[model samples]
Target: MKFMAKIELSRHIPLVTLIVLVLCITPPIFATKNCDFPAIFSFGASNVDTGGLAAAFRAPPSPYGETYFHRSTGRFSDGRIILDFIARSFRLPYLSPYLNSLGSNFTHGANFASGGSTINIPKSILPNGKLSPFSLQIQYIQFKEFISKTKLIRDQGGVFATLIPKEDYFSKALYIFDIGQNDLTIGFFGNKTIQQVNATVPDIVNNYIENIKNIYNLGARSFWIHGTGPKGCAPVILANFPSAIKDSYGCAKQYNEVSQYFNFKLKEALAELRSNLSSAAITYVDIYTPKYSLFTNPEKYGFELPFVACCGYGGEYNIGVGCGASININGTKIVAGSCKNPSTRIIWDGVHYTEAANEIVFSQILTGVFNDPPISLDRACYRK
Candidate 1:
């Protein structure tokens, strides 16, 4: 009997091995990709702004999109922004701006970013002031409205309503914040001293933390927070400041110092938020280091002119005139033209980064090296 049992076990070994091999080769029907985050909800300023501000202000016209899209898409850059790249990485459709009244489909995501938007509403401004209705606070309100509408349609059993379940979408989607740069820009342009600007860092950090908490209450769990890049390295800043004050890289040193200071404080604030919101996966992305690297080592990034704007006119950095400016050159109308090769430059206009630069910075941001807690977006969204 023992010999017979041994012979039977030996006969089953081949069948078991085949079963194992089949299982290894075939993926589970319900298995999800690591980077398959369900949706994205973006908020901030022009760096990620697709068309929100443009819908209202009619800015970023003509030569602004001459590089890639070959037509104005209301994006501050010549082409796509960082948010577009993030969406593409996850196999998601490009997000539409929330304020895009002309047939916006929110099944994928919505962008609430607007150029010149500030984190907090300025006190001195009246309620009817320009762009006041589209501040970050207003964006949050719009998000609430979107959720309510989506839930209503889903409950009504509409055909496309099932595309996103309200609870699952909010919980699984990544919330991205890329604001603070505009706040700093406003302070500097307002003639605030570096010391005075530093004084406002606490309030700025607090406001951002408070917004995160509010979004947490709304069921958002994953956040990708971007630190301010080297604003002093922007061609606009270089043109505005005296040449004598610029560093060896042609970037204003004091402004960059202020940006670094803000980033430090912001990081600390995010740490405290992580401790407070135990279930939240909040990742702070260091956009400064990678962006500064491109400026300091342009050759490595294939950028020949890291300090110059590819679509501006006048001045050493071609930043004395803004993109799309129409100048009367010898009584003939001459529009500021874009460079022949926008891919070879880091800066796009005087203020924003080229699509190529945004792509590079976003690639670094996803490597887990720039993220706090060292978790990449793929790992953060992975089910296992």
Candidate 2:
């Protein structure tokens, strides 16, 4: 029997060697498929805010979640932000805001956006004093760093930890950005012409590109950047416009034109980023069109009042003059009210969209949700 075994080994030695070589040289084809490991990072503002600022500010019951929370959760809308809907759609747990202490689980993700936050630091306003800027929010997120090397929270099963060991930044994570609107609004108010705004656009894009790259350096691979909606048609901005006559569609032609230009330029920049940074996956959603559509055809869209919010008094829809709640002015009780059906309307207030509208937008984004498709950090990272 020993002799027979020796003869067999000698005859099949080459075949055995070939099998070993194949196992070492080629990986299983199925292993390279989708990585549904779940997302871990998010960045954006009130549009996607999951009740971040609402907890910090103080106001009467009238100024808060009257339509939903029946009080305030700190979120300045009728109900949830866009981020909440997206997370829910993805089957991930609801996200928690960075500055607050409401949520304990960091395994899923965290929302670093604050209400009244602008991409430009020190450039935001809220009912409760100044708001957090994009730069500041980024700083705040760094502390609770989700990177492997800077792991503030470790996993028992080493799920998130294994992907990004201590100090490793770019594990299986997704970074989102819903910005640029405030920059345009502030620029418009600051005497900057559209041409001037256009001039600054490139620099802003470059800075954002650089910032995203920095996030990539920290280990983020998936990115979702947003475009501005028809800013010219925002209820309050229209009130601010001194010259243009309102088109029945509620679209301020000039303002919409500016938004159009920004989207065009931003599109080009995003395309360039995708092509140049093929290693990182970057996805851009056209929030401008869908959001603008709600305003353009409010009636068709089941919106009874498009120009004014449901939570304000009088026709002007001014929150300070008794909006969000019914305030007592000089002993005279003032009260604002929500619409009959918030689900049908889009704008929650003069400047923001309602939960209903957010759901609508989220559905639209779902059709082409972009991110690192399980691999190729270079293609999905959005950073060169």
Candidate 3:
């Protein structure tokens, strides 16, 4: 009779060497062709703000969300903003504002963006002035608090646990940024020359990078950072500085140039960050190109009145008062109202883009043609 001898591989191989062998053969989680982003954590200003400003102060009045939602939804656009389209593309629920306490569900993620927010802290906060108190630093602090609070609430294992994001969602989520526009605008509004505004770009970009680093340190790996758009093309900017040089598209050339400079510095800083943070997937999205294109060729993209406000009082750009406010015009009270057709207009309320414009911007950006390193939003999870 022959007896079979058992052979144990673990006995002969060292524990550390066997562990290394196992790790080497296994593929990284992000190496998969299909990159799944479980949630979206966003920080920005009005361009992507869902409702942070509104919750902290007052919501925009009627006709703001009339184009799509048919009511006020606290978004700056006529209907949805770029962030709403982003959430829809991922098949996730729209992000609830972190400041909004009424019936907010953060299962997917939260938005810390606010209108008039800057990467650097503003001189005036809410109740004292128009600028938001939720600057990038403050937003990061809020995010940190959110993490700790949500973890504690989720650990209780009740119905609330289903409402909060899962523990793994933080690392698996995409972090978006659409700020820095206000930083430039604030300088111009403060009576600073274009050169002065340009001079401050480096410091503003540095503050932005610092906030990103803080967020990255807190388990954020996937990032979609949007470059500031062409503020010069905004109706308010155009109307405010009628003497400024205008491009062929009627946008203020100097203001737009300042914005381009900011984007340039931001891109350079992000490139350095990408090299340093090798594990992070940081994408610099060129929001300026697509937004500027809409202004230059509004008709090409089924848009008209590119520089005109869809809901303002008066002027060549149709902006004299706030979108939904009433003003006394020659002893007669008149309310600022939306245009007959908001879908045809590019600018919504002298500042933000209309829903139609937002959709167009989203479509163009999703193609990855306007993104640095040329990666689409869906593929943003993997480092290039």
Candidate 4:
């Protein structure tokens, strides 16, 4: 409910210049908890992306990671993402990106999340005639390949390969999914009407459920599936659809309706999956309510601005340009900058969440309340 006054000096400075100054002045925070989980395998879009897409994306640069790592670590936030917090909670090291070959270590599992990843391969509807290469299906293939190679090495008596128990790793490891946001958003952005997008919900949920089934067949038993959040509250959505009606919390109402519908179907599909895979402890995480609550009552969660982007360039809500956009000032190019207090903001860079927001959501997920069947990650992991 409270808003920080825009910095007068920053208004005159180039965005890039302001970000460099902010990064230099800001100090990183270090806080982690201990929990019990052998390993975590994450697959999703930007919310869980730990840099697997950095090689082909722009998030692995300054400003994006300025708040947390002080530089890009391939995450789309100012600090550690939700998956990072989950890993740290279990006393595990930050999962390495499956794409990064340097010092590849699978001892603690690998993150297959990539920014802009979608649920379907060709996308529900392609607006730009482009398909994301790292779809959920592709990420799953990468996971299968990683496990296969590791198994082969362990079988051949390779040293250090035995650190991960070949037979139990996949079965014991926790599989967490945070996808589906892109599929819905892309559908809307591609000029698909709300009705048309709604029509694709069954197919989207089908693909998602099918992927879970495939993972289950591959030996995964513990699953933590995150439902799509309220995309209508995203700064990017609001900016793109200025005429859209606002909800009680000032978010775009129509977009959120679509998101709710998607979550409903996803939850139903997950229920059916649970029935089919009786051996799998599948928990559907309701990410929408917790995240939407933060926006509705920002003060309750220590956030000042819930809908505005902390890092962006040129727009009413700072959603016109991406976090890394650059502008020329008097023939000299200056990069777009971020907010001074990212911790006080909910949305980060128009599309992602700040580390603070992620922490809050992570806490909700840990409590077991947001999960279907009311099972926490710890319960799902340790259950026999």
Candidate 5:
């Protein structure tokens, strides 16, 4: 049940004017711009989903965006998602959603993250349908670019056609893909043990790697590869398994091990891809340790709540209340609660992070995992 990515109805979307809100916490850090780079295009699941799935789901008032500016902003967070933070950190205007064709901002890029989307298949856990898999999502984007080019060609006739051809839409872009959690979620939620899930993990991951290759072939040079986080600690998972073992930080170690294994293999695959495609810029951003550090050592980060989400109760709650009120393993109601200031806590809903959490995560990306004992992820993306 893949939802269409087309915007047939062109309504005037009331643009909300965002003003500069200076935080008493810290003045916004000016991001060093990569002048040569035009934008950072992100694609993936709920972890980094900006607005790719807004049209996919039915997020109305009350349940979805009760805490938002009186209405849902098409985001799954109380405030901002990871991609928003990333754009701010890079000093680029936030990437728009694939569904939005608001001109003049196309150069900055767009978000293709459909909630519930996995890398291998279109697995949307949202009350919606089958979901838009990473592959189909990419294809949809490619088609959208084609449509955009068609519009450009018709407009320019032959004047600007030669210089700004259809192919150039993607050729001049970078793709950031954050995917692969639902695949694992399916295995666990289904009647499968860790060993059973482990067997298919390689192929599942390879499916995404191949998609990455497909994107590279499509002229995407720069890519941000986001890995998975602990499964057991997620509010939904925690709620289902009351007897689940917990680590020092109360995060389930056994579930984390699964994520650790996948990350290790995926990292190896990415390293090989980098060597194979020397012309490409590939960087792996580990969302685990950075967030884990926050959860494990809240005093260090000065956050109080770690395990339960500030947004929803039950065992889990994302900013959008993803796991909140979600059917328990037994199809029961198990959610309700919201932390006062999502800015202070990390976990937004059960599975995602707060806007504040994303700030810290992006900090790690700009200078932590993605950084080197070096300049940039690859020489190709380095500023001259």
Candidate 6:
């Protein structure tokens, strides 16, 4: 019996070795065969806003879209933003701002993002204020209204109906959220200390989670949420906090810490959401990592002058708080002009990113490396 057992074990050894070899050679499958998201519904602030704020208020003047469209498209960047690249990746048309009714098409998706938007309702503002009136709550309400109104328009059936997306598209579409940076900045610039600003993160994240839940209830199943970028690295923050301690990369240390803390809390909140909304595929994209890398190692990415604004007036960082517009400096009005080559720079207006930088960010985040659950943009709809 012992001799027979030894012979049987030896016979199975080749099978075990073959199994191990197959496992080593073949790549592991992290997600289901790529999901076919029918459309995309986006929400956020300037980082992703196509033209919502411009439609509601005044459009950003010349030099804003000079790189691509050869005219102002209201985007804060010199050319296209990340949303534009994302739409193109899926072979879908650029998202039309919900507020833009003129020459707008919403067959694929709609953008509810507006410049200066916040996750929570901002304090009341005066006329032509910098902060936007469209908070995350307001955007949620608009999305809810959009669903009902579009369904009604499609039911009527006409030339207008052709512009509306089908009813099933809502549940099948990808939902992206890229707001929250303004929430941190508002506190810091409003005379609040770093500690004071950090204290508000929990409430702010709670409000953000509530809105995500609200949208989920309205049939949103796939979510891609971006954490705030490194505001400390931007020229605007560095200029405002000239006295603050700077990191090796020349970014304000305290401000970036605040951003990281917010991301930590936001990630914990999202974990809870995953459990609560079992059917939903929630992806937490770490945009901060790749973005900060651009500043830390700009040469590796074919970028130069990572912290300096490409389109701004005079300053240590080539920014005078104005880009593509005229600003008064020392009693003299000067126009913040574009650089000779925006493709070589990271910062665009001291507040937003350039088209080149935005493209790099999108490319990195589209890979599974920066995403929670390690799912790429094409696999965002699949549950891990």
Displacement of residue 106 (Cα, Å) in model 4 is: 1.0
In terms of lDDT, the poorest run of 10 residues in model 2 is 370-379
The candidate with the higher lDDT, 1 or 4, is: 4
Residue-by-residue lDDT tens digits, candidate 1, 41-81:
99988888888887766757788776667888889888888
List the candidates ranked by TM-score, beginning with the highest.
3, 6, 1, 4, 2, 5
lDDT for 128 (candidate 6): 51
- CA lDDT of every candidate: 0.81, 0.63, 0.91, 0.82, 0.63, 0.91
- My TM-score estimates for the predictions, one after another, are 0.87, 0.76, 0.91, 0.86, 0.75, 0.91
* Model 2 deviation from the true structure expressed as Cα RMSD, one decimal place: 7.1
Candidate 6 residue runs with Cα over 4 Å from true position: 1-32, 126-128, 327-333
The local lDDT score (0 to 100) that residue 101 gets in candidate 3 is: 95
**How accurate locally is residue 178 in candidate 1, as Cα lDDT from 0 to 100?**
88
Which ranges in model 3 have alpha carbons more than 4 Å from their true place? 1-32
Model 1 weakest 10-residue run by lDDT:
124-133
- Show the colliding residue pairs in model 4: 15-337, 16-335, 68-78
**Cα deviation of 51 in candidate 6 (Å)?**
0.2
The superposed Cα distance between candidate 5 and the true structure at residue 239, in angstroms, equals 1.5
Please provide, for model 6 over 148-253, each residue's C-alpha lDDT reduced to its tens digit, 9 standing for 90 to 100.
9998998899999999888999999999999999999999989999999999999999999999999999999999999999989989999989998999989999
Clashing pairs in 3: none
Q: With candidate 4 superimposed using the best TM-score fit, by how many Å does residue 77's alpha carbon deviate from the native?
A: 0.6
Name the runs in model 4 displaced over 4 angstroms: 1-35, 56-59, 123-131, 158-166, 382-384
> Lowest lDDT 10-mer window, candidate 6?
122-131
Off by over 4 Å in 2: 1-37, 55-63, 68-70, 123-152, 155-170, 317-322, 369-384
Q: Put down candidate 3 lDDT per residue, 1-384, tens digits, no spaces.
A: 123221266668888988898889998766667567889999989888888999988998987888888888789988989999999999999999999999999999999999889999999777887788999999999999999999999888898888889999999999999999889988998999999999999999999999999999999999999998998899889888999999987999999999999999999999999999999999999999999999888899888878889998888988888899899979999889999999899999999999999999999998889888889998999789
Error of 6 at 301 (Å): 1.2
